[model samples]
Target: MSLVRRIMHQGFMPLFWLALLLSAALGLHQLETLFQWIQPDTRAVIYSRDSFLSLLLNHLSIVGIAALVSIVIGVGAAIAVSRPWGRDFLPLVSQVASIGQTFPPVAVLALSVPLFGFGAVPTMFALILYGLLPIVRNTLVGLRGIDSSVLEAARGVGMSSVQVLLQVELPLAMNVILAGIRTSVTINIATAAIGSTIGASTLGDPVISGLVNGNTAYVLQGAILIGLLAVTVDSLFERLQNSFSVMEDRLIK
Candidate 1:
């Protein structure tokens, strides 16, 4: 197939288009409301462009940083615990990640405020914690899911322990690991909205402000934007997972 055709067939295209449509539609709706509010005779309060942009940037930055941290920690921890010596520590790590997921994002933000102090720090911390579980769990599952015979074969072929893991196990387990990272990223995108609650500027700022002032339009705008972002990221991850799966299949064959 031609490159263009292959690109079109990939799942990410449709998702990207869908996200664009949603964003455009939502943005237009928001703009109309904003224009109406700006009229001198209108009773509604106007939302400034600066504030809106700041809120969006804050959210993007927080989610991006959180996902980055989660990837490093989650993947690193996963790799660590997959080894023989680290295997015994897996349950404890799993339990901790589970606790992170169970813990309220807001509560984490609140607790972290004192130590991390406002802005994006507390928000990033909460999101990192919230996003760790899926990646770590998936890493463990992926590494463990590798066929024992395959691992033994690699070792018998004179591959070192590290070589067996890096060259044999990890390649086979890439699909599951990518899937977990995708899940963690998408969840973090949604959860990052809570950052606005504790004085961290994010898409949630509009929603929270709208609630305070009883403005449904603003709330809807923020809600739509946040939802679109999450959908877009999720779709991208799905494509990545499919690609990884295909690679694993080809490797096995």
Candidate 2:
């Protein structure tokens, strides 16, 4: 009963958002009347070049792949630099990550098209580059933010360096790290839409097509789905972060 109640509290918003996202992707054609009202002059209101569900899936795949790579590289770099031997390279790593973010996503895509050609590859590359900064920065902050006294205590209790890092530092820093990931993923979700311009199949296809053809309905559909996806992912991350915080508090008590 307690577990059920807890799941209900934590799962409701994410589930709601997920339901809306899925419905929009799978059942958007049902809203043709609404779209027609929005774009009365246009012959076709709902985007039909490709299915919304397909676009949504492709978008997720791009963002998911980019985010996975970003998390591994970001978290790994942060952990490495936090150690004694690697501390000297921290500034260089941070500067590189920041520079990666400074470049515009569109610019990166344009630059990548020649190298990678027009497809998901360039989009994923752009997303990975653009999404890296937040995760790396947040990871650095999280790992660096751990209390030195607590770390010393861990060592005092005869824990090795690896054990202290694994058992003490990572756990304490997880919430902040998760926040960084949340931000990165949210940013990638929106930016991934731009990839449609470069021939990447994403939810942004409708928006790009709508703009090119002056069809507002298509734009609205794409925007709605993209917005819903971002909200859903952010909410899920919030729940996870909250769970971590609760566990940390109980441990402290």
Candidate 3:
């Protein structure tokens, strides 16, 4: 066990080191372009620093809001449909989530534009729709997967339904819930790039610009950065899930 722990620690150390190195490299590259943008005399390949920052902030905000909204609605929907009163509604909700996933983001934007107008509203709506399935489905799966014995025991102890859910089911199912949130967030990060198509500024701005101007370098830069960000966030969530799993294991033991 000590040897296994040592090996795992060694593996993690190098992995973290490499991630830090790559992050620093990307940061330096971004900084160099930023410095060039601010220098009036320097004509950089990228646009002005202010423009880049604005685009980045706009994209992040829209994506962040969309992901947040999706989490709340998706988790709520999951919990609702899990209960006996709402069980019959599960299929309908699942169908809706499926439809949302099947619908093209571009199509959602097109339809939403008429109702919500241009800018972030349409984009955010589309993102939330696109990002709901994993979270909702996972929540259902997690809740259902809980051991029946534990639940019965809780009920036998005179626990109310709410108490059983809060103290037993939810705690046991939290890792799965976190996993769903992680998946949703990562998917949103990628889908958020599509928001740029509807004039919602985001990291996708550079990639779109690159596509228009045939700037492979800029497209690569944007794509790589977005991929890296998604991977990092997903990894963080996986770690969190594992931590919860460990705690649950210890409790069970």
Q: How much lDDT does candidate 1 score?
A: 0.74
Per-residue lDDT of 195-244 in model 1, one digit per residue for the tens? 77777778787678778877666676677777777776677667666766
What ranges in model 3 sit over 4 Å off?
A: 1-43, 49-54, 98-100, 104-106
Point out the worst 10-residue segment of candidate 3 by lDDT.
Answer: 42-51
Best by lDDT: 2
Best by TM-score: 2
Candidate 2 lDDT over 1-253, as tens digits, reads 7534665687889889999999989999998998888889878999998898988888999999999999998898888987889999999988887777777777877788898999899889888877878898988898888888999899999999999988989888988999989988988888888889999999999999999999999999999988998898898888777778887898778
Clashes of 2: 0
Would you list the C-alpha lDDT of every candidate in the order shown?
0.74, 0.88, 0.72
| CA RMSD (A), model 1 | 3.6
Clashes of 1: 0
Kindly report which residue stretches of model 2 are placed more than 4 angstroms away from their true locations once superposed.
1-8
Least accurate 10 contiguous residues by lDDT in model 2:
1-10
- What lDDT does model 3 reach? 0.72
